[model samples]
Target: MDKKKPKKVFVEGAIPPEKIAQSVANHQSKTNIGAHSIFLGQVRADEIDGKTVYAIEYTAYKDMAEQVFHEIRESAFLKFDITCAHIYHSLGKVNKGELCLFVFTSSARRKIAIKATNYFVEEIKAKVPIFGKEIFEDETHQWKVNK
Candidate 1:
């Protein structure tokens, strides 16, 4: 069964802090969910060749990314006893210290929620065709890869 529909997961630029708070508020009424786990991916100021990264320009094949995201969510639902899940990823320039991706999962127990959140993060990193161009302090850039 398709327990959930394919939803828009991409956000422009940086993922705002308030978005996280709002998500919590939105689910407060879902009393069945006893535990919630959230994973926030922040752009790091990675130093390389005497330069520090100031921002990251992200891009993706949107249609394919969405399909992959949907498939991941469906698999997670089957693998975990989760009540709900949500994901948001940045599609443009995100500064160091700003959030780039957000993955939230809710379940009746701590273990399921925690594991599902980790699964979602890992799947996104491995399966999503997201590209990040690290822009350094000196305006120089380099391609980024998840390590």
Candidate 2:
């Protein structure tokens, strides 16, 4: 009998690029996929209503976040004939211009890869129970989401 490996989806406390890359490689190794799409979300120091963002502190309702992410993975699998998917989001303080979210999807063709990548990122941002506190350069802060 052939065994299937488990997929990884995490609401982590701070993830490095190397770790995410390793996870992507692991998922790719499981199938003979021909395309891979990755999206990396970075914190930016920008002005909001006259305030400049200095950094961001991320937080999540972990259990719900994980559950939502899992559903996204399942939906991606059902909607697209893909090889695998992974999502990793940081849970603590992330400095400006630092990576906070990473999404990787691989498939047998480029069409599905592109579609699934877009769908994955959109769904996660809209549905996941993750929150971000944007710190202003003047020491003020506010919670932010994809607008």
Candidate 3:
């Protein structure tokens, strides 16, 4: 088990581009990390039943979601020889083309970093309780179904 405390993963709104840059910058001092992989999940303006999605309103049971996220991270650490990992997911409203999720992983090798990042993304999409309501251009909305 990871002895580190769980990280706060939920952001109140769409993640800013600067935040992504800052995250990368923060890792510059970690010289042992030979490679880094990142995954960004953006809100897509999808046309559903003639209505176009313009944004997504996300909500979650915060406490439970955080616990699950911590568990996933712990499992990832045990499964991969990653030097570092981070995950940020948005809550509340996020406009189309905005970022909703950010996953970062670092390792001594390129393949390990890339595989760790992919594992985080897939596990998050399948296990997290966070829900997204896709808002249409016409002001209608539908609950998004994760694939």
Q: List the residue pairs that clash in candidate 3.
A: none
1-147 per-residue lDDT for model 1 (tens digits): 645668999999999999999999999999999999999999989898889999999999999999999999999999999999999999999999999999999999999999999999999999999999999999989899788
Between prediction 2 and prediction 3, the one with superior lDDT is: 3
> Least lDDT summed over 10 consecutive residues: which range in candidate 1?
1-10
Stretches > 4 Å off in candidate 3: none
TM-score of each: 0.97, 0.86, 0.97
> Global CA lDDT of candidate 2, please?
0.81
Q: Ten-residue segment with the worst summed lDDT in candidate 2?
A: 1-10
> By TM-score, how accurate is candidate 3?
0.97
Instruction: Flag clash pairs in model 2.
Output: none
CA lDDT, every model vs. true structure: 0.95, 0.81, 0.95
Candidate 1 residue pairs in backbone clash: none
Evaluated against the true structure, the overall lDDT of model 3 is: 0.95
Instruction: Give candidates' CA RMSD values in order.
Output: 1.0, 3.2, 0.8
